[model samples]
Target: MVDFIVGKYNYWIYIVLMMIGFYAMIGKKNLIKKIIGMNIFQTAIILFYVSIGCKKGATLPILGHAHGHAGQAIQTSAYINPLPHVLMLTAIVVMVATLGVALAIGIMIYLKYNTLEEDEILKAVK
Candidate 1:
């Protein structure tokens, strides 16, 4: 069963990392730890995108028609999906934005209660 599952999808490593990051984010109570978890999650997403863009047998996506060097038009048959790359790029940008905002909020929360613990902050708030 393990071999069959591994053979079906070679990207299990990325999936595992993503799950770890998700688990950290959910399991941590400290705001800083949560942010680190978020960063890990984002990195896992980037890795997943890069893995998806990998093809078993394909040339780089660079066209070279200007220098009279005509080998064969880059094979389009084995080209990996570019959509994942593009989406990952957008997701990375969004992750940065979210991190920035989260940091700002964390700092504000710290200032208000002088604590990094979520439970402490809630207790102080109440």
Candidate 2:
């Protein structure tokens, strides 16, 4: 039972992290906390993607044919899928950009209201 659980545990961890991030975002009253939650949420997603991309005994997909002349050789074996890694890289960039924007907006809000509390900002806006 332990082995079985261990074999397929990444999904469970991903779900738990996702839920924690969601709860933090919803339950926190501070802008910084919400941002942290967002970061956690993004990290959880990245983790899920990376976990899914992993192959049990595959090597990085680096084509040796690029540097030398090789007759077309058909080889069928395990090779790491580069798509997920590329997608994750793009996702990381987008997440960082999003976080930067969120932080900038939060800073603007703080400057306007002199507080980082969501409730206080809402009250002040009213």
Candidate 3:
């Protein structure tokens, strides 16, 4: 049990963070708070995905010099997979864009209603 917990502690941490973000998004009343929660959740997911791509005792994917000898083979296990890193980069860009758009909308709503609270905004709208 100790070995399992120790080996996978990062996963547990990510899960806890994800839960907090999820709760904030669902349980919070204020629009800004919900946006913050969504950002937290996105960060947790990005971290989780990046962590998954990491390998023990692995080097970067950059190729070393080609050996003159024919028997020398590049070991796949020596290099870490780069796909997850690239995907996470794309995800981060998307997340930032989305957050910017959402915040802009929030600001517009606030300007019109003068309240960031969802309930209050609804009341104002009605």
* TM-score of candidate 1 to 2 decimals: 0.79
Number of the top TM-score candidate: 3
Q: Which regions of candidate 2 deviate over 4 angstroms? A: 1-4, 64-76
* Candidate 3 accuracy as TM-score: 0.88
1 or 3, which is superior by TM-score? 3
List model 1 lDDT by residue over 65-124, tens digit each: 646657555556556667778888899999999999999999999988999998898898
For all the candidates, what are their Cα RMSDs to the real structure? 2.6, 2.1, 2.6
TM-score of each: 0.79, 0.86, 0.88
Ranking according to lDDT, highest score first: 3, 2, 1
Per-residue error (Å), model 1, residue 61? 2.8
8-120 in candidate 2: lDDT tens per residue?
Answer: 79988998999898888999999999999988988899989988888878777676665563666634355677788889999999989999999999999999999999999
Q: Give a tens-digit lDDT track for model 3, residues 65-99.
A: 54553478778788888889999999999999999
Instruction: Give lDDT for model 1.
Output: 0.82
On the 0 to 100 scale, the lDDT of residue 74 in model 1 is 51
Runs in model 1 deviating more than 4 A are 1-10, 64-72, 78-80
